[model samples]
Target: MNSLEHLQEKVNYDKIFDCVQCGYCLPACPTYETMERETHSPRGRINLVKMVAEGKASVEDLRDPIEKCLGCMACTTVCPTNVQYGQILEGAKEVIEEHDVKSMAQKKVEAFLFESFFPSSNWMGTLGNATWLYQKSGIQKFVQTTYLTALAPMRLGRFERVLPDLPSPFERAFRKRRVLPDYKLRTTVAFFTGCVMDGIFFKTNQHTVELLRLAGAEVLLPKEQTCCGALHSHSGKGLSAKELAMTNIEAFDLEDVDYIVNNAGGCGAKMTEYPHLFEQGTEWHERAKEFAAKVRDISEVLVELDGLTFTTPVPRTVTYQPSCHMTNVQRVSEPPRMLLNNIPGLKVKELNRPDFCCGSAGIYNLVNYDESMEILDLKMIDVIERKPNAIITTNPGCLLQMKLGVERHGLEGEMEAMHLVDLLMEAEPAAK
Candidate 1:
């Protein structure tokens, strides 16, 4: 079958009609703002999908626009007709991946990342250990001093400079699986420690668990939970994404916990939409709905429990760069701000475009480095205007991207980038 046939067969061609070519999504689209092209905007892309389905354009015509999309879903929020753009986007991605021929090396890399690296806890743990060794064994320093990093790809070198210090192998090995509240337990929650969250930003994950415990909850770190499959779903590996979703559903079980809380906005948004990955009326689809309903962002849970009260003051001015998925997909905008506002002396300055994508839609920055940087530069313009001490965000991708933004704009020493949980931990009293 041809690409058009695959798209017709697998893609949600019916939903393409939902987009009415209304111009509301253009202003909200980061790519449209940056690229100044109709082909890059949400309505423009929707039209392209429609054209492909009707045999007016080949699937190849849709490839660049689809691939270049941050998949931030900002347009969906502003749409008057409530267009399900995400489903359409993911459908196009799957059809493209199905038909496009890839070189051997590219195929191998995709196989490794989608099938092996992301889904395995053991592999993620090993990655953490490897990174720790790179940072701690003087190798990083040698590479930096010897200018070896200069020889590497520009994006890799920039990312390397902002890479967070990983917890030592010993620390990761001895990490706690569960923590009980020092005070009376108000509820029970199973924390979704994400693959990247566990491997790279392990300290942030640690802080999340500690904060949840302090908030009067019993936190369970399920052993069987794997990656949330956001990356797989975004990349068009639908089968792999479904497998990971099922693994996570079985891992959390949802029988004992009042909520399945996650700190990463991208992971939370994806987990909450698990029901979309399966066929309606199927057993897995129903099971996915049950699991998705239990998923909650940590900030939402904290607000629900009235758990934020900082005795100690954090005397710093900060601006929030919200995660796109958290804000747009998860429909969580105010909780992080509410948490930030509760800090004693921390001043919150709003960005001009608070809902703008930081251009770190998962691995978009890595794959589309130049385009990502363009979007980040646009985001940093509003951030620079605030002149805050730190740029705070929820997801790890945004955290790193914001850090890179701070570094790229030569604001490194003047401003820092931090995860919201880490900042909140700073405001907690020392004796707690």
Candidate 2:
């Protein structure tokens, strides 16, 4: 049986028809906001999906909306009737794949990794350990010398900056089950330690757990969880994404956990789409929805709880890049700002185009480097104008992309980027 047959989700009739064609989602959509094409906007894309389902639209007609969505799901949260557009959009993507097709090579490369790696943390850990070993053994230098990995979509320059070397901050792997010390009440939380955090940003992961523990929650880093498949879905490989969804469904076994805490904004946003990926009558499909219901970004977690108690002073004029996933995709505009304000010396300076997409729309910098860099270049100028000491965002993709933008513009650490969770964890504001 095919995957969609397993998802078995009924088309949400009431919410789907609620669109008034006002085109409000056009400005709200990053890609549509960037391209300004009707086909790319939310309403236009909704119409296109409707036409496709009703047999009035061709597979070729789908190319734009699918490409345009960024898989951001920015439209649904803002829609009055609460149309879960992400589910519909994902269904459309599966349909598109069923009819039209790409090259075997392209399909193979995508399927191999997404199917193989995304659902298993052990396998992912191996991949990370290999990369870490490569760098440690100077094999990365050899690859750079030979211009090998650079030939891939995400080049050495891009990968080098984003891939932080693990500094051996904490040599302890989080127990499959653990308890927190700061228990006002024992709240159970599942964690999505994404690929970067699991391997590269180990400190950030530790910080995330520390902050969560501080906030009174027992955190679980399930060995079964893998990549959130956010990048694959965003990159137009929904079939692979479905496999990942299935993998995580079985792996996580997240029952009894109150929420899946994701420190990274992009991963958190993607985790919320678990229901949309599977369409039919399988456990994985149900599990996907079950898991998604519990997902929360770190900022959202902090905001929902008591505000930050900054232990030390931040003392920096901070420029805020509302990560596309956190702000537009997930429609979480306020939580991050709220977290920042509680810090002792932090100044949350807003960027000129706060709602606009940063070039790093997750592997966007790799596949669509030109446009992505172009977007970053403009964002960099805004940062330069602000002359802030730090730029805080909630996604690894944004932090890396913006950090690169700072570097390309020759600013480097003079202007730094960090995850909002990491910043707040730093500000644990002990009772003085």
Candidate 3:
């Protein structure tokens, strides 16, 4: 658990009562599927939460099960009662953070990431540049070849392998922030380049912007925008999340843009739920709703744009692993499929569990690597069986997680992982 506070005050007690315990969510939950225990299921987790809220069970009793949840919201897809389990889990996480105590190292790392690193673009740029240097300077090659990287902590060592090559300096990308279409701008759209998205998958974002431009939309990359605070909210730091939401609300001039476009499913989902971050009847709440109203996933925007067609053919048998946030929260399963199917020669195969969580629930894979890998291994069985040439995903975390799965199963020679935006860009005539 992130924190172990009383939890009663931190959560919406009434939401717990909304679950009908119909067992429909059990099969859909990755943890339940992995552990095959009721405690790990959504129904069991809700009941545990209700017990804590009612003071019948201590917070300690519910901590393990609650913390183990991937927060993927797959259960909600099957719920008959329309239970908002994701919100409930977020509330539970908040209470845990408030009450659960942390060790000094934990506290320091959390502070460094949440406070110092994420909120500032400069810090992220510096770190990204350092990572680039580590690779470009040949130090990374030396460490990997000498097996020195293996000496690092397990999670850290694994995370090192998953790190994508950093793009050129942020300044280079920022220089091309505002892009205009060749003929005429049908509409002007703001692109929400997320913190990690901009830092790590820089080329993907660049491709997204170019594709949007090709679709005749003027893309605006807001300079004042910061991290989406999804990680903070998931970790139970609601205040930090709210602060970041307000900062974003202030950053974007909503009236000037037709849509606030996001390529990352997780960031897009969180930004779309900005209204939930604020209180009812508050000014920020109203602002949040207005801001969220304009928010659209890149797929949502791309599929709707007229005259947007891929002239370059991509000849590969591709299967999509829809990011959990995209399918369940953003409610965007079809737009990507519709867009991919538009490609002339591309074969878009459907995975057995397209919406299944890749076990890359934000930082869940890092903190719970063993259990995460367990869930991922299950997903990989289906992925490997399907035997697609490339696996495409909409979010960075899912992209990395899928890559990790390919590496772990020694399927690198047979399959490759790619971001959807990158895939589309590869199928664009200009890219050819």
Cα TM-score per model: 0.95, 0.80, 0.94
lDDT of 3 by residue, 347-411 (tens): 98788987779999887776677899999998899888787989999998999899899889888
What does each candidate score in C-alpha RMSD? 2.1, 4.5, 2.9
Enumerate residue pairs that collide in model 2.
Answer: 6-280, 6-281, 7-278, 7-279, 7-280, 8-279, 8-280, 309-429, 310-429, 311-429
User: Per-residue lDDT of 84-174 in model 1, one digit per residue for the tens?
Assistant: 9999999888877887743343345466565657888778889889989999999999988887887764346777888899999899999
Candidate 3: C-alpha RMSD after superposition:
2.9
In model 1, which runs have C-alpha deviations exceeding 4 angstroms?
1-6, 101-112, 429-432
- Measured with C-alpha atoms, the lDDT of residue 207 in candidate 1 is 92
- Tens digits of per-residue lDDT, candidate 2, 1-432, equal 343333223223344577778765666676665667888788888787777555576766876556545665556656666666766665566665666543343355456655666546666666666666777888878877887765764354556744666543125343335656454744678777888567666678778877777776777777667788886775456776677767676767744688888878788778776776765697777778888888888777766766236778777888898876776556678878887888887877888877666777665565556656766787788888888988887777788887787778878768777777677766664421
Cand. 1 TM to true fold: 0.95
Q: TM-score of the candidate numbered 3?
A: 0.94
Off by over 4 Å in 2: 1-17, 50-57, 76-84, 103-116, 138-150, 153-157, 167-179, 182-186, 231-255, 277-293, 304-308, 328-331, 428-432
The best candidate by TM-score is 1
lDDT value, candidate 1, whole model: 0.88
